[model samples]
Every structure is written in C-alpha cells, then in structure tokens.
Target: MKNARLATATVLTAVLATGVMADAGAQPTSLMDGVYTAEQAATGKALFEQNCSTCHNADYYKTVLQTWRGQPLMYLFEQVMSAMPADKPGALMDTEYEDVFAYVLQIVGFPAGETRLQYAGGSMEDIAIQPAP
Candidate 1:
C-alpha cells in the first residue's frame, strides 16, 4: 500500500512539473509596463461609465481576465470590438476601445505604463495578458 501511494505521488509530481515546463515555453505573459497611461486610463474610466457601465460592472474584470488568461490581448480586443454594447456592435471608435481597455486595466489594478497603449494590429497576438498582479 505504501509503495503504491509513493508511486502515485511521484507520477503526479512529474506530471505537474511537465505542465509548468510547457507553460514556461508558451507565449510570454504580457505586463502592464508602459502599456497605457494614467491619463488614458482616466479617460477610459469616463468612457466606461458613459458607454459600458450599463452592461458591464466591477465584476467585468474578474470575468474577462479569468476567461482570457493565456490568450492574446488582440483576442480580447476583438471580442470587445466585435460584439459589445448589446445594442450596437462595433459602435465605439478604435481609440475608444483602447481607452476602455485602459480603463479596464486600471480598475483591475494593473499599473499604467508611461505612454498610452496604441492599437497593435498584428502584434496584439504576441502580447498575452498576464494575470493581475
């Protein structure tokens, strides 16, 4: 019985280690560093209240970040831009999206970067949203 338990534990440990190793090589986690500005985030907050607050609330961050943990920022961005507002899809301006995302990051306690985050067309796929710090 003792030997069987030890074998099972050793297998579980190896499996866990392998999983971690695979994640290490996967796309790097994105950081908030220099991604957006305090000013942008502030503006984003206003936009959020006016345009987004109706459908989304404080819990929005938890839901979104948790769902898109390992996905690219662009994936999240596209989802927001494509089918948001419920009343109208793709209604907001591109900058508005950025601003809204900045606001989201701000509310989630992500530190603002020096410059405002610009829309990255292709590179967004490369930028993974890291788990909130």
Candidate 2:
C-alpha cells in the first residue's frame, strides 16, 4: 500500500509539472487565421464612412499598413484605435476597433475567415502581422 501511494504521488507531481510547463509555453496567435467576420468588416466600413472617410481613404490606409508590416497587429490596431477620427481618441468600443480591423483586412484583400481576428485579451505582443502574400 505504501509503495502504491508513493507511485501515485510521483504521477501527480509529474502531471502538475507538465501543466505548468504547458502554460508557460502557450502558443502564440496568428493573424492569418480568420480573426474577423465579413459582417463585422461591413460594419467597420460603415463606421469608416461615417467616421474616417473625410480624412483618409482605403488606399491611403493600405499604404499605412504596408509601412507598419512586420509589426504586432495590436500595435497598429492600438495606434489607429487611439488616434483615429482626428478629434476623438479612445471613443470607440473594443468591438468597433475590431470591426475596423476586419474592414482593413478586407480592403487589403485578405480572405475573410469565419473567426474574428485574434483579440488576445487586448494584448497582441505574440501575434505578428505578416506581409501580404
């Protein structure tokens, strides 16, 4: 009985150690995965028309994206989210930012997938925006 208890304890310890390691080595998110819905992009388009078309157009935004490639998607998202509308900053909802992101993705011809783009609990340090293929 004592030997059985020792073995059980050893197994439990191994399992716990593996759990810790797995959590520490969690996988990073990728923007290639469809992170935003097409409908969401449409919403973004409407919002853009109402909020952003006066100052910039899709073509100009595309150039900005090109300039910011190889960077974290979150950085660009945050930068635009915080500084957009020229007069208003941080006035939009998280979902609004996400919708605009989807619109940008669609404008750039990235195939819209079923999944909403990676949101990563508001931190996208792990997800890199790859250059368009």
Candidate 3:
C-alpha cells in the first residue's frame, strides 16, 4: 500500500513536469521583439497610404496599439482584415495585410526586425501585443 502511494506520486510529478515543459516550449513572444522586417514595413507603408490612408493614418495606430495591448496580434489582424477601408473588406492579399500591419508597428515605435510578420495558421497568435517600453 505504501509503494502504491509512492508510485502514484511519482507519476503525478512526471505529468506535472511534462505540462510545465510543454508550456515553456510554447511560450508566447512579445511584439517588442524584432518580428517584422524594415523592408516589409516600407512596403506596408505604401500599401497603407494607397488603401487605408483616407480613413486612418500613422497617428491613429497609437490608440489602436493601446486598445490591443496584451492581446495577440492575430486579433488586431483579423479585426482590420474584416472591416477595413470602409467600403471594401478583405480586399487585399493576405501578405499585403501583413505588410500593412508591419508598417503600423513601425510608425507606432516598434522596431523592425529581420523576419517578416506571418499570419497563416495562427502564427500571429503567438505574438503578444505589448505596450511600448
């Protein structure tokens, strides 16, 4: 009976440890990390001007970032993708949307990184929207 209790305790410990290790492996990355490329941001700037400038500008994104603070970037991406441009929604290619998002991040004081932002398969969900430090 004592050995049975000991074995159950060992199994529980192993299970808990495995859960912790898995969570650590999948930890979310912060938006403050260099996650988008400068070139991508530049392209995004042009796209924003061409498509989104009439309704929104770089300054507008400050409020947006604040509202989205602590949320996954995927939420913002989806929100914009679904209802942007006022007249036409979901009009741009997915990559174009990503580029526009990258541009917004740049204007809002986030540093551009070597990697381009990705949204497919919920990849953007892993990126947390953090306030500028």
User: If candidate 3 were superposed on the true structure by all CA atoms, what would the RMSD be?
Assistant: 10.3
Model 1 TM-score? 0.72
State residue 37's C-alpha deviation in candidate 1, in Å.
Answer: 1.0
Stretches of candidate 3 off by over 4 Å are: 1-25
**Candidates by lDDT, descending order:** 3, 1, 2
Residue 51 shift from truth in candidate 2, angstroms: 0.9
Lowest summed lDDT window (length 10), candidate 2 = 20-29
User: lDDT by residue for model 3 over 1-133, one digit each (tens)?
Assistant: 9999999987886676446435445676777888899999999988998999899876678877776665667878999899986789999999999999898888888888878898886667777676655
Residue 124's lDDT within candidate 3 is 79
Model 2: how far residue 116 lies from native, Å: 1.3
Give the Å error, residue 122, model 1. Answer: 3.3
| lDDT winner | 3
lDDT of 1 at 65: 83
Superposition error at 78 for model 1 (Å): 0.8
TM-score against native, each model: 0.72, 0.68, 0.77
Q: Is candidate 2 or candidate 3 better by lDDT?
A: 3
Rank ordering of all candidates by TM-score, starting from the highest: 3, 1, 2
Candidates 2 and 3 compared: the better one by TM-score is 3
Local error of candidate 2 at residue 104 (angstroms): 1.2
lDDT of 1 by residue, 17-120 (tens): 44643655654436565577889988888888888889878676777786666566776888989988768889999889899988888888788877667675
